[model samples]
Target chain A: MIEICEVGPRDGLQNECKIVPTAQKVELINKLIEAGIRNIEAVSFVNPKVVPPMADAEEVLKSLPKRDDVRFGGLVLSRSGLERALKTNVDFLHVVTTTSDSFNLRNAKRTVDQAVGELSLVINEGTASGKGVAGVLGTAFGCPFEGEVPLENVLKVAEKFLEAGCTEITLADTTGMANPNQVQEVVNSFLDTFGKDLSLGLHFHNTRGLGLANVLAGYQAGVRRFDSSIAGLGGCPFAPKAVGNVCTEDMINMFHGMGIDTDTDLASILETAKWMETVMERPLDGMLLKAGIV
Target chain B: MIEICEVGPRDGLQNECKIVPTAQKVELINKLIEAGIRNIEAVSFVNPKVVPPMADAEEVLKSLPKRDDVRFGGLVLSRSGLERALKTNVDFLHVVTTTSDSFNLRNAKRTVDQAVGELSLVINEGTASGKGVAGVLGTAFGCPFEGEVPLENVLKVAEKFLEAGCTEITLADTTGMANPNQVQEVVNSFLDTFGKDLSLGLHFHNTRGLGLANVLAGYQAGVRRFDSSIAGLGGCPFAPKAVGNVCTEDMINMFHGMGIDTDTDLASILETAKWMETVMERPLDGMLLKAGIV
Candidate 1:
């Protein structure tokens, strides 16, 4: 039971400009279901004017394929944003904060303490509504503006997320600057501290080509759930000239080849990603989508 | 002791269409030497027509700066090629063989056994001539033609190279398909078997963007020497689809940032790489060359 949570519809769409028609967004999510991805991040409930790419989140949710077995999630950055997500039928609400002070200020327009406070509120509201809550800590490894984030800072952030009633915590290498050793040590530290209090997940970028290595480190450190974008779409607009997320098909191919059970059809994911690329009208940075995963 | 071994004049040139002027190759090597790269791989002694990019190897060598600290080496694939190298005034000679049968066949047109026989003869000649000898085990991690090369096979080849009286061995991720775990395991096994009877080095490709990961893995496993081309030059003509060696500037940037001492100045190496790029009239693949590692 390998869990691969597709973040393309939310993370990928939000990062780039080529906006897909709301109906086509539903088609892509439905196609992912047809290809057997059970856990897909469908969209985000942010301001339409700010992140124009995800303006049709409500429409995208209304047109889903209606599978009880599959769980759909949406990303949210603030408590007010959670109101929009609560209106939809998303199975989980994902919230993100950063370990670095500068990144939090730059990306979320809040200090780390402020962002964590907001996340706690979102967690309380989501649990009250009987929905899953996920906490994503961005720039957990290193930050471009501020180099070498301390391990203690990350631990404190994770502790805050878990204490705030987050069912799951995702450590994101947001800047794609994490090395293998750092990934192993940080993930292991979290596991040792929290154990079953939270389910751990990884979100990595392929910026310096360390995505697979970081994922391997996370795997060795006992992480099973991960967030990947189809065709490696979605760079942080916050990051200056950043690359996309780890390619979904390539990640699946590597995991499957290593006898890891990732319930993903690599070929079908490629086909769906290709369709997204056609609609986007720009080259999405996914390798397996183009290379076809030998 | 930071040892920067420039492989651009050889590795970078061997895979290109435009033949760099012999004087420019010599100038590039001299500039690297002035910039404090002590060990520079001068050129490869191979058939000129087979690789038109390296056709002026002898002329290029003749024009190199005369410096006692800067030692020059040449790459050769067979006994005959090593014999050709013996005619040059190179400080060292690098002999290459592949642990993977398919890669060895395609790269050098010889089986492992045949390559070993040639290695023994060349080692003897190299030792008698009082020149340093290094053996490069190409595709030590994974092969493009045949993937998932075993650690046992690579270790066995290393044992043979040590037995042939070679002093140094370079474990090459020839296709850049190695993960950090694989690198650590292979390097650990090599260190266990060789026990410093031979020095261990790494040659990596950024094809899959695991170059730095592999390098870090090797370092943790106790390897010190590494081969890198300026601007990440010189793909395998046989495997042109794959990326080439790790960029010298990028490696230096990582090591220097980590407080590890590399004798080469990153800025100077970058400047020399830029000059080489202009001389070769092609795009250089090294990220630091473009990104300017802040």
Candidate 2:
């Protein structure tokens, strides 16, 4: 069984052009939890002025129903964001940086080294607060700005976070510029250095329509955990694509069809995606919702 | 090395709501030939009264610039359609039948047995005419009408076609309900029963977004020939799903990216898809055309 971290509320809603209300965000998270999603990226601790959709992250976090078993995480880029998340009941703080300093500078307004320094602070703070920390290594496969990032660069950053006591790391294809062979090669290189037991995850976008294909490669290469948005929703607001995130329902359907257990209720997850589509007033890039669970 | 028979002119245009003129149809085939497509399904000999888009099949075939090295084929359902194709310069004749009796009856107004009986005449005529014959087994994976088609049923039909001297068989997922695992299982079963080097082919639709994924599995299971459409321009018009046919450009990108040789010029193919977009006045389902040859 693979663990799927639902990133619909934070990543999916953050990229929407319209602002989703705090209550709806809470409801989406609750629905996901009800559907057996143990870990959910409920909110992003980013600036409200820049990303207006995530403006009510704190309020949404406050409104979440108390659930002892369900653990919710928040994406935090800077130490200030981490400090804010630490004040909330967020079970984990997700630290993000890139293998390419160029993408890091453009994406987070900080150099890779500087971002690693901030990550140390976030990891330490989360450790002090007894909350788990996950490092999201963005642009780990290839960077739009830097073109091809070296495998050594990705592993070095992951090592930094793990050395700082982070629980796990997620390799993200920020631009969806990855193919299956490349995914397998990079995953093999990561596991070769980091050992097989590392709590590794994969984050992919359906930009080039190879999202599920890449996931299969990653699975074959031995990475088990994955991050996906409900309706295949979410793209970077600054730089978007046709769609972002592999549709959770479609991935679940494929995995279930193959007898690879995901432990996700496909019907409930699909209903959440439909609700998300209704709230956003737009059709999502998911095929299962239209195909009716194959 | 794999052979990708361009089906944009036949299977593609046959589904278009508006009629694509004979001149433009010829140009699409010519452009594909220039881009190194050796096999082109240029026309369908079905009744123009029933499928108006393919009304000019003879006109399109006559207008095609003759290249002795390049082979052009036409799809024929009935013996009358086969006679029309035999009268034309079509180098190969394609026969199609469905695995499900219900689909065969609805699609061609004939039962599976009746269709296979018709296929015998098509094979014998093609053999006498000295033209290669290929059988398209529709719904070989599963049928929308029959729910789940048995493997033995699929092979029984193929065995009849092969015994009648059909050169190769193309398994088509007409409804695009196939997943990678199912695709692998079906392909493996076909290969195990039929022997290796059977000249097997795969035709997929992007209806459920698993077209390329299925292609990957088919390749892994020893299928070297594939059917694709330019700009992803075809669908089962009677039962369409967001523009079907696995995008030829996207498939090429994936194969080339993975170091598989597909002896086709991607730049010219993409230009053709772009030209097709202008001609059709619509964006295509293919990702590489929109993503710019990642």
Candidate 3:
């Protein structure tokens, strides 16, 4: 069985031009939970001036119905974001940094080393507060400014996160520049170095239309957890020419069609994605929504 | 190295509302040849009333540059279509039928067995006339109306094609309902039943967003020849909710990105796809065209 972490409300909506209402964000999360999504990155605790769509992260978190079966997460890029998230009832803190110094400087206003040092402290603090802290290495595959990121750089960050008491880590193809060969290589290296017990996840964007292919490669390489957005809603606001994330319903449809158990309902997720299309008031980047599940 | 047969002229433009000029079709073929594409399905010899975009099949074939390095194919559905193709300077005749009876009936106005019986005669005639006859089995994966097409049905069609002296066989996912597991299974089955010397190609649609993933799976399963369209332009006009074929430049980008060679120029293909977008007067379904080659 593969584990899917729904990132629709947070990562999906962060780059949208329209500011979705707090109620709609909460409602989308509820719909995902109803669709059997247990792990969700529901909101990001960032400044309203930077990402206005996530202005109500605390409100959205507070409004969500408490369920033992569900775990809601919030993205924290800096100490200020962590401070805001620690005060909320977020089930997990998605501590993020990138391998490219330029991307990290632009996104978090700090260098990669600086961001890593601060995030290590944040991870310790969040874990002490009884919240699961997951370290997300952005641009782990390649960076727009740096072109091809070194695999050693990605592994170095994962080691630091593991040392900082992070039980889970996610490697993000922030720019959607990853290929299947690279995905297989990275997944195999992680498993080889981390001894196959590390709880690893993969986050991908469909910017170049290789998202699901990379997901298939990762699954073949022994990685189980994946991050996807409803209606393919997300893109990196800081990355140039970035598009939506790997879609939730389409990825689910592929897994189910292949007889791989994702343990999520495809029909229910498709319904949520259709509802999200109306909320966004435009045609999103999902394919299964247009071509119904086979 | 993988062989890609460019199908932008026949399959891509067949379903378009606009009728592309014969001269422009010749120009697109010339552009693809300059980009190192050797095999191209330039035109389909069908009734103009059914597919208006391909009304000038003879005109397009006559205008193309007669280069020995390039092999241009024309789609032939019936004896009349084959007669039309044999009169032209087309290098190959792509004789086609489907695995599903409903699709074959709708597409060729004959049952699968009847279509096969007729196409076997067409193949023998084309071979006697010194033209390469490649058999294309449509809906070999699944049909929009018939749900799931059995593997035995697919194999039976291939056997008939081989017995009729077709050296090349293409398994087409006419409705885009194929999964990776199915692709691997079918490719393995075909290679196991026939010898490794058989020339097998895979054609896929991006209807459900599994086009490239399916391509990867097929490549991993040892099939080298693939059919793709410039700017991802083609869909089955008769199939409900069918979308575009796999994008040429994106697939090339994937193979080249993974250190696999297609021997096609990425920059040239992207320029052609962009030009095709202008020719179609709309944004096509291609991703690398929008995202640029990474």
Score chain B of each candidate by TM-score.
Answer: 0.93, 0.97, 0.97
Q: Which has the greatest DockQ?
A: 3
Q: List the residue pairs that clash in candidate 1.
A: A231-A286, B2-B263
Q: How are the candidates ranked when ordered by DockQ, highest leading? A: 3, 2, 1
Tens-digit lDDT string for candidate 3 (A232-293): 99654345466888999999999998999988899999999999989988877899888988
iRMSD value for model 1: 3.9
State the displacement of the C-alpha of residue B287, model 3, in Å, after optimal TM-score superposition. Answer: 0.6
Q: Write candidate 1's Cα lDDT for A126-214 as tens digits.
A: 88898898888899988889998898888887788778778888999887777676787888888888874459999987765557667
RMSD of each: 3.5, 2.0, 1.7
Q: What is the Cα-based TM-score of model 1?
A: 0.88
Off by over 4 Å in 2: A235-242, B235-242
Candidates 1 and 3, the one with greater DockQ: 3
Cα lDDT listed for each candidate: 0.78, 0.85, 0.90
Over 4 Å off, model 1: A31-36, A148-151, A235-240, A253-259, A270-284, A287-294, B1-6, B34-36, B144-156, B235-240, B253-260, B267-283, B289-291
Query: Per-residue CA lDDT of candidate 2, range A115-152, in tens?
Result: 99878888987888898899999998788878888888
lDDT tens digits, residues B153-203, model 3? 889999998899898999999988999999999999999999788999999
Q: Is the docking of candidate 2 incorrect, acceptable, medium or high quality?
A: medium
